[model samples]
Target: MRNWESFLRGLLISLVALVGCWLVAGPTAHAATSAPQTPTSPPTSILGINLTGGFTQQPIDSNVISGHSVTLSAKGTRNILETATNPLGSRKYVWWESTDGGSTYQQVGTNSTTYTFTAPEVTKDTPLMFQCEYDFTGLGLFYNEWSRIATVTVTPDRVPTTDIQVSADSNTLYNGESTTVHATLTPDNATDPVTWTSSNPSLASVDAYGNVTAANTSSTMDGTANDHGTVTITGTSNGRSDSTKITVGALQNVTVNEGSDATFTLNNLPDGMTVANWYKVDDGTTTALNSTASSYTVSKTTVGGDNGTAYYATLNYTVNGSTKTVNTNAALLTVNKSGLLSLTAVPNFNFGSTDVASVSQDNTTLENLDEATSGSNYDGNDNGELSVMDSRETGGDWTLTASLSPFALSDGDTGQLSAVILDLYDPTARLDENIPATNTATKIYTSSDYDGQTFDVTDSQLSFAADPKITAGDYQSTVTWTLSVAPS
Candidate 1:
């Protein structure tokens, strides 16, 4: 009873003392107005990168030969390249290389919009990882947080490509244009190499690969009456050689717009040579047209096949009373790309203000373009975008072509940039982004490509040098962008 009484007395004394102190301290320091707490923003960028999915296209997986280098590219999600308000496309690219299969990365490149890396020094079985990032340093905004990990695998060099054979997509190559000389090697895994060389380089030239391009000239080739003559292209591998006879001439592929009447005809045929029959080849099957006339016309309604459906004729000629058959070169059929296809946008190339530069400048470049804005004219810090929309209403292989018109002076002056050419290279296109398996083509300049879908050439490398000694004035030119339907 005594202990309880003492505890109660002590508690009563403590409460009385606390009340006395609070009365003296004027509301116990909890009184008076407190300042409002302003909320701070989360973040606009992380380490100079907008991590909210800022990249539209990133580098993909690639397989390269042992000694070759692979270029990994990334495109930002922005519509335009650069502006006063936008520091996104200021061309600050850093490439990270991961040799241990993307576990850790090391900095490798700080070059242009694209980054390149040579082959790995280690075993190439594991795929290497590369990610391109845009670093803005002290700038408040960021362009790309990180890019898609571009996986690269280096293939074995070669087992010595033995036993090779060569063939051509077209027996006759048109001047200034090109045709692929498809080469087939035995053993499938044989990788030595098949070197292609032209006997008459003046008539035609063959590249390291088997692409044969004839010389461009208004004059007929070979001094033959029909503008047809053969150039020997030999492919050699391991002491074995296969020769392909490609007739170099001015045989333009037949283009039929919107299934219009396309007459399969040849001009300037020899007097003694007569056409035996016109063969329509489809899917490795051949059928005779049965008409022995010099030409055959395909009706508009009959043009239901794919573009580049071949129509070739066999000529029957008497050599010393023995009738022999010789097949003439193939003429590829093409349907017109009108309503079925359209070139929705073409971003003009602006070389910007330049001092008279004749020192051979391939360094001229344009920033990457993602979505093309309407009337989007890209200056030196420009966006050169080429877009094609294929509706699949009707058409052939959807092809988009661009040509540079002559430089016309803004002051109504007449002269030439003269041999100064602005070449657009390294254009990329995806047939359908919705379909992940569809191919992404890098060569969109003049190839028979794309169909039944829409896509954009996000970035095209544009470059040239102005004549150093030329007159100084503001000069402008228009790029002629054309759309056609041809088969691949």
Candidate 2:
């Protein structure tokens, strides 16, 4: 009987130790093993009392971008029936965050139904963990447990600016004109601020805000070069930049006389162009010219030939790995000249003096009638003694005729001589057309054939037969010449 009594006492002590172990480690934050324990089950029954239920709304897993904030919320409900019967405790809520997959936790928020936190700058390899805990310590029966663990995922979104495009409201500006610059950034969410600059401040100036103003007309900022010069406006951000060209002045039309060279220029042309191309617009037709110069000239212009002509240039450039093209304003050209058709120079023939004539006398050598040739000659020829010019703008017709009178004795000795011929040797030698020359009228040249040019004729002589009963004392003859229109 003594041995049985000692064994029963040892068994009772062992049972008390088993009950103490259950109270040491409470339920998991989620009641990890199963549902909350009841009043009869001491280890999991909300500190052995039932005044409130577990969280009705716990923190849910969420995703957020870097540099942005996210809100977390949780709520617990009271067992009104149980709480009214025993209003013993007020609960306190606390939030916690764990970085190491829930290995340990640190308090981040307390006594709040909601918590807001910012996302990290870079995404983490593993998701972050968060939880909410409730405590009812003031009441005689204390309750302790935590809400289910929630996860937060973060990702980076504020990327650096990769490209920037800049433009101007007015690409072409006059002196004293103002314009604004606009810029666009790639990826839209970039955080870098754009800086503004000007390539040539003398032609144009810009402010930090991208506002631009053109140089004044009278300004000698760059020794009169800025008055009509090109300038570039650029915007840079995050090591990326883009530029736009602004033409300071517009193109102008010019007027010039015909038969002269005319020059057309584009003032204030921007740089970085790829071998500009010039185009001429004539009679409603646009054709490409061989010229590539910004200041181009049309050589030896004709009267009204290029009147009302317009020219323009295509400017191609590169910016930020992109190619772009622009055209300068059209410039017009006008040519003016008057029409004229009048004789310029004429040739006079001189026959060498002879005392007496025998059978036949001929003068072959021809002398031009200039200041030193015996008389004043109005019109002259380049290769000969005869010269004619037609400065008319269009085509015209003209004729030259000649006649001879009989030779007579100079001393009035009642002597006469005949059979004299004045041959105009190779009249077409220097004239425009190959027309035969005779004593009668003949068509020489027309403005259409030799416009804005001269007509010259040479090689004329006199051939005469001596009179048998000749009483020669010095002989003379008269030759008549006439220039008439329409070949009359």
Candidate 3:
């Protein structure tokens, strides 16, 4: 019984050993059917895209920058969506880029990688695109697509401008004269055209091409001879515009009277000037008229005078083109009436006389020499006195005379008479103190018959030469005196 039991135990041990060996071997060929299944379709698929969400063309992004845009990025897509998984290997992703918008595509990179592309031209019509995919064939073939489309835009550059000029034929415009002006408009950019406009059409007019014409219209320009108008021209081009202005006028009218009324028209005068007009009236009328000439004559008309018949005149002028007028401005003229003054005279007047030159000899010699004894009485001396002869006074036309009359002078002794007029009216008068000879007085003569000589005096009375011819008449002259003496 012991031998049989040992044999059976050995067999049981061999069976256990065989089972352990089989369990130690690798999976069977059919083990794959019992493995966990891998998905055939990807969890996410790309349907559309957003060019700029967080993606940007700018290199930095702490804060948004101006004048820049974000680059293309995908929209409605999940970056973490599941792709087919392989038991032994990691899944890889692929990406593509396109320059012509999204018309066509090309492979750019592989594996789960970010795709970068050369920036497209920034223009209004430029196009660009991007796409991505994953290869999951190890477990199950699948793809997660992401894409974006875009266009480039370009900015603009420009500005506006204008030009102005003026011209006239003459510096001076008459009251009835006119002139023309030309203005040319040039723009900075030829492509951006300009339109022309004016401010005052009444004062002046400008054509479409900028030709200006001056119209004879009334104006209120300060300091202008005549009120006139002004013109403003504007040029517009692109998005901007500019303007300029001009003034017009003529010389003002010259005035004659202060309170006179008259409307006078002038022609052919310089512009922006002020002057006065000459005015005059004819005898027998109160109406005054302005002369086209610079000077004018006055007639007996308009003057408020009696039947005596007299004439008056006036001139007109303007100052700084002002309205103030000077009445009957008689700047240059004189009126005379006859017999306005009278005259008188006084004559002889005993002008004091002085002793002419004289020489006396003493003949009182003791007649008989005392030695001869007889004492004779003989003594003689000549006593002479000279006096002014007469005094005459007259009121109506009278005359005063001065002369050198010689009398009792030695006939052949050769004597002269010189009378120095000391005083003509009063003999005892203080002549030098009261009246003196004037350098400007006209001289009168002592002759009766009025002679051509208004004055005459003896050259040398001592020599008894010719007596000065004297006369008196309507002596129209200043006061005068003479020096005279007679030789004895």
Leading candidate by TM-score:
2
lDDT of 1 by residue, 308-358 (tens): 576667677654356767565455567755454556555554444555553
Off by over 4 Å in 2: 1-250, 338-432, 435-444, 448-488
Which regions of candidate 3 are displaced past 4 Å?
1-180, 185-201, 207-250, 253-290, 294-488
> Candidate 1, TM-score vs. the true structure?
0.26
Residue pair clashes in candidate 2: 229-268, 344-379, 345-378, 345-379, 345-380, 346-379, 380-387
Error of 3 at 106 (Å): 62
Write down the worst ten-residue block by lDDT for model 1.
432-441
Q: What is the TM-score of each predicted model, taking all chains together?
A: 0.26, 0.27, 0.19
In the range 1-488, model 2's lDDT, one tens digit per residue, is: 89999999988888777655643543323322232222111111111122235654546554556777777766655443335543755777777787776767777887888888887777543467887776553323346546768777665654577888888767877555556676677765454567789998876888755767676553111122345557889999889999999877545466776556888776554345543687888777788897777677887555445767876666666544556555555666777764544454555555545444444343222233323233233233334444333345455465555565566665667875556565555444444332122333434444445344333444555555554565645555554455555632
Ranking by lDDT: 2, 1, 3
lDDT on C-alpha atoms for all candidate structures: 0.53, 0.58, 0.30
Better of 1 and 2 by TM-score: 2
Q: Locate the minimum summed-lDDT window of 10 residues in model 3.
A: 55-64
Residues forming the 10-long window of minimal summed lDDT in candidate 2: 39-48
Candidate closest to the true structure, highest lDDT: 2
